[model samples]
Target: MKASLETLEQHFATVIAANELSHAYLFVGATNSGKMTLAQWIAQRLFCTNVKDGQPCGECAECRRIEEGNNPDYLVIQRATRTIGVDEIRGLKQELSKSGLEGRQRVFVIQDADKMTPAAANSLLKFLEEPASQVVIILTTTRLARILPTIQSRLQIVTLQSPTLATREQAIQQLGVDSTFSHVLSTTQFSLEDIQGWLEQVDAVQLQQTFWRWLTQILARKDSAFTLVQTQILSTFKEQKLQQLLPDLLLAALSDLFTVKFALNRPLNWTNQQENLQQFANQFSTQQVTALLEIVLGLRSMQEANVSFQNVLEYTTLRLLVVLA
Candidate 1:
């Protein structure tokens, strides 16, 4: 559904028109890049009773049921926890072994396929090895490296591009947030679901402004910057509230600042805050900004590894101070 996936859509149309649909496919892309949406569209196309020009007619009963998640022939498997267990893969194999309930073909979509446990991934590899005649398997993931190589070898991998700023703005508006907040969120590589969850907990506009103010203080070598980190970032927000997301927001802002400072040709993610970014960019040397960006980026991996958020923030502040000095 994302505007950025036009090329991918055309490719699928061509494949269907040629009657060359693959048995197994891997959809790899950044989060919120429409991998799942494209997978669903492909499933609809395969299941639609009224297909026109290699695309689903959308008005067909089968297409409507698929859209409503009530299609008997279409199955979606997702991780209920941090990892997909081996049992889930076994269950999928069982489902695939049976005949299609309503249609001639069966489609299975596995979301976050990279989150499969090693055993689960091995099991999936075995399943993928034996192709069913009337079945299609589509796996979607933001982290392609985590998937097994044997499994990857069996799939026809399709890479997806990130959505444009304008497309993201429209999505944000539809989520019931002010469109201006997209200026802050669009800079970061977050999925639509991730953005919606964050917005539900806090005002994204205010959070963006607060991060900008904190970064400005750090750039100016103000003692209050550390104070803000301790009080606002660490003490006030708590780990559950802002730990993982704050680092990403900071990184996004710093990246924009670095681009502005170097007069890069790429578009700024925070277009609405151009004046503040320009001012901040003027205060830092290229080396200092680059160092800070690297530090912030590392924080993302650390956060994922279950590092202490407070320690990470304090260390980040110290590192920024050292870079600025």
Candidate 2:
């Protein structure tokens, strides 16, 4: 469990202790926001052999089983493909209908609930109309807008707010990123998983160091980035994977730099390089920054064309020089 979710833990534990648990709950947040962890915590609290004030003894056998993803009464339904169809929901419904004559509690967690097709959502909606008191259904999704309105209204809504800056930085550090680079990486990437995935197959530290160095050089020189581009940007980041990510990185880097001009409330990617960012942003009028950002924003489409990643970077550099001149 994440330290940032301590408040949620306290609130939920009290709810469980009071026996006011809702039969169905919808957890909405970014993928790495700990929704699944919270669901598991609820299960452990209910099934723990030694329960105290809604908190479970993590050492208990049942708690261990759930932690290992093998608890018999706890079933997880995840989308195996792009869409979860009606059959999956139907299967879950059938399982719930079985009479336990002995009556043991059962928990079903559906991951990426927004991936469910209309038919599947409708099937689940019918089940929600009259839920079984002994059964619990938990749905997790990153996109609440994609969830059907009728279904959304039926379940208890749990909105996980964006992680605080301290929380995000701490998580980035735990992922083996350097403390110095954590702030920049966290600002560029929305989630910890995204940061991890974005750095995949690349030397994370090298990418961080080289990228910032290259960006700094370009900012300091207004005439041309040709020397830096050839010596640094082109020398490294040659692989297809790195090329594929260049546009996104450029967009994020520039967007973060833009934050300095407006007293923007969002995080900055290069907080340590505030002077450089301010100087770079200061040279550009509002109209110029807007145009430069627009160009970088369109770099994604440029990547999809026959243009090489190196070509894209060089082209972007040329555009920046043009704007400065």
Candidate 3:
């Protein structure tokens, strides 16, 4: 099941209702952040005939055809390739030259627009300058910084926030993780696909439990925090998974603690330790939390510099202890 984008869904529906929708849009977010889902929802909201309460009647002929990928007016350009080449953009441009088969409105969605080669991007850039009146071009990308400023300036940008903690927990459960496991896995900013990949390679739940214990020990200022790295963390988790997953989890945890310091009503990745985290948050000022975050980020960069994973983790723990002190 997909997590609901209730606010964005409603806003797009209202825009469609008023006929004030823009002809171009750029959806920006990390993977599994509902970029494609929101694009399809907008397509349905525009094409669905039996509208309900500013939402699409998903069962209608128009919506079903769109869902089944049989709609003549709706087009999507996405393929499994390292980079989108110039020829593909030509095909889209050729298609855009024609009138719609079924109606006045036509929707074109380009997934991973950031994958376009320079030539392909230039071709698409020309199209974005002037388009058919009722045609809408939606481009979704995980890397907005890579896109050219010329292309970016042409479209109305829509950003999808990271999924909620409850949404992520549900997704993890659906991956067959035990419901009894602490919801710590939800705190890491990984896509469900990436999470599934790691889960297949290692016992993520067990590693999370170990990490949680180590984390709590660190916050409690216990001496055992230093030894837990060798005894629990390094022993239980595979090196590859540790390199891939641990740093991001650490960053997410540090980010949540930063969020906690301000008493913000935001979701925490470490929901199970909310009480302890808040108590810890109270002890540190905002500058201290920022320092902690920078330390973790520096450790991440050290990994890129080919520092051994054990050294990175050991050093991270030491620096955290020093900073939190």
The number of the candidate with the highest TM-score is 1
**Number of the predicted model whose lDDT against the real structure is largest:** 3
Ranking by TM-score: 1, 2, 3
Cα deviation of 260, candidate 2, in Å: 3.7
Clashes of 3: 0
Q: 164-248, model 1: which lDDT tens digit per residue?
A: 7678778877887665566666655566776677677776656766776777788777768877877776543552635656776
Off by over 4 Å in 1: 1-19, 30-33, 80-82, 85-87, 117-119, 143-146, 173-181, 222-230, 234-243, 260-267, 271-286
Per-model CA lDDT versus the true structure: 0.79, 0.77, 0.81
> Which ranking of candidates, highest lDDT first?
3, 1, 2
Residue-level lDDT of model 3, residues 109-134, one tens digit each, is 99989878889999988789988788
RMSD of each: 3.9, 5.9, 6.9
User: Residue 143 in model 1: shift from native, Å?
Assistant: 4.5
For model 2, how does the per-residue alpha-carbon lDDT over 210-252 read when each residue is reduced to its tens digit?
Answer: 7777766666654446666677776667765456556666676
Worst 10 residues of 3 by lDDT: 180-189
TM-scores for every predicted model: 0.79, 0.67, 0.59
